[model samples]
Target chain A: EAGVAQSPRYKIIEKRQSVAFWCNPISGHATLYWYQQILGQGPKLLIQFQNNGVVDDSQLPKDRFSAERLKGVDSTLKIQPAKLEDSAVYLCASSSRTFGYHQETQYFGPGTRLLVL
Target chain B: SQKIEQNSEALNIQEGKTATLTCNYTNYSPAYLQWYRQDPGRGPVFLLLIRENEKEKRKERLKVTFDTTLKQSLFHITASQPADSATYLCALPTGNNRKLIWGLGTSLAVNP
Candidate 1:
């Protein structure tokens, strides 16, 4: 079985430019998540999706960040008008829905490292 | 606000010695705690999980303990090796929500 996959492992852009990262989760996993990991800090949950529908996005910076998991498969996270502080690793993870036997033991992707100048 | 803190500073230890790392939290009671290992330029990999109802869990040479009353978790690596060097992260669910929150992580370096 293949693990979660992410594209454009590293990205560099200007502070005001926009950038997008893509994630293809493990097969059969129903829950997808996007997290921001700043340097020297733990990952912060930006959004979570359950079969293409958002389950939680309370911590996301709604003004400049948005994510979508269409068709309940691959997902994308976008940061517009990126700020200097937006330089961080964007991690994508997936797990079986926490409803039955499968709890939320997330499997993370390699992550996209973004550097804003 | 709920917050989780791991001893983020790197820990250096002899290859044959044991290594212990700590995770502490404030203002929230977690249902369970999890540990993950992250190597340079790679995403975190799950190592262990211990619920509040459980006291300890072990796998191979890795051990994890959770203390709800103390809002902390401890991770131990026995018979450590250079291969064990990496950042260890601890995480817990937020409130009644299912979203997991993470700690900054403790970096460990096992020297030969």
Candidate 2:
């Protein structure tokens, strides 16, 4: 089976500009997630979706960041009016489910490296 | 607020030695803790997971231990090789939420 797939592995944009990243999860996976990893920091959860419904997005910057999982398979994370701090790697991951002792491991994509000037 | 922390510095060890990494957290009791390995310019790959109820979990040469009372997890890689060089991350599922929060990670370099 194929692993999660992401587009535009690298992106460069100026502050105040907009940028978007796409993700295609593994087949049959019901959960998708977007995370931001600043240099020398861990990936922070930006949003999570389970079958087209948002499971959580408390960390997403409502003012400039938004994400959608259309039809519950693919997801897109967008940032408008990017800031210098937005220059980080955006990672996408998916898992079969989030319940039970066997909490399935999340399969991640290559991630999109964003450099905001 | 919840926070996860891993040693940010890189660890250097002999190829045949054992490598140990620590992850500490506060303000949450996670049901499970997971370990992931990431390379430069790449996303993390899942390595192991240990639940609160379980003391330890092992796979191949990897071992993970979860201590609920101490609010920490320890990951160990035995018989390390240069191929094992990478950043190791620790994650804990957010309380009542379906999200997993990760630590900054510790870089390990097993030299020959």
Give the TM-scores of the predictions, in the order they appear: 0.96, 0.95
Q: Which stretches in model 1 have alpha-carbon errors above 4 Å? A: A98-103
Give the per-residue lDDT digits (tens) of candidate 2, residues B1-112.
Answer: 9999898789999999999999999998888899999999999999998988999999999999999999999999999999999999998887565478889899999999
Error of 1 at B8 (Å): 3.2
| Residues A7-105 of candidate 1: C-alpha lDDT, one tens digit per residue | 899999999999999999999998899999987888899999989999899989999998988899999999998999999999999988646532368
For model 2, residues A1-117, the per-residue Cα lDDT tens digits are: 999999999999999999999999999999899999998888988988989999888889999999999999999999998999999999999998756544568899999999999
Against the hidden true structure, what lDDT does model 2 obtain?
Answer: 0.92
Q: TM-score (0 to 1) of chain B, per candidate? A: 0.96, 0.96
Docking tier of model 1: it is: medium
Backbone clashes counted, model 1: 0
| Fraction of the native A-B contacts that model 1 recovers | 0.77
Q: State iRMS for model 1.
A: 1.7
Question: CA shift at A2, candidate 1, in angstroms?
Answer: 0.6
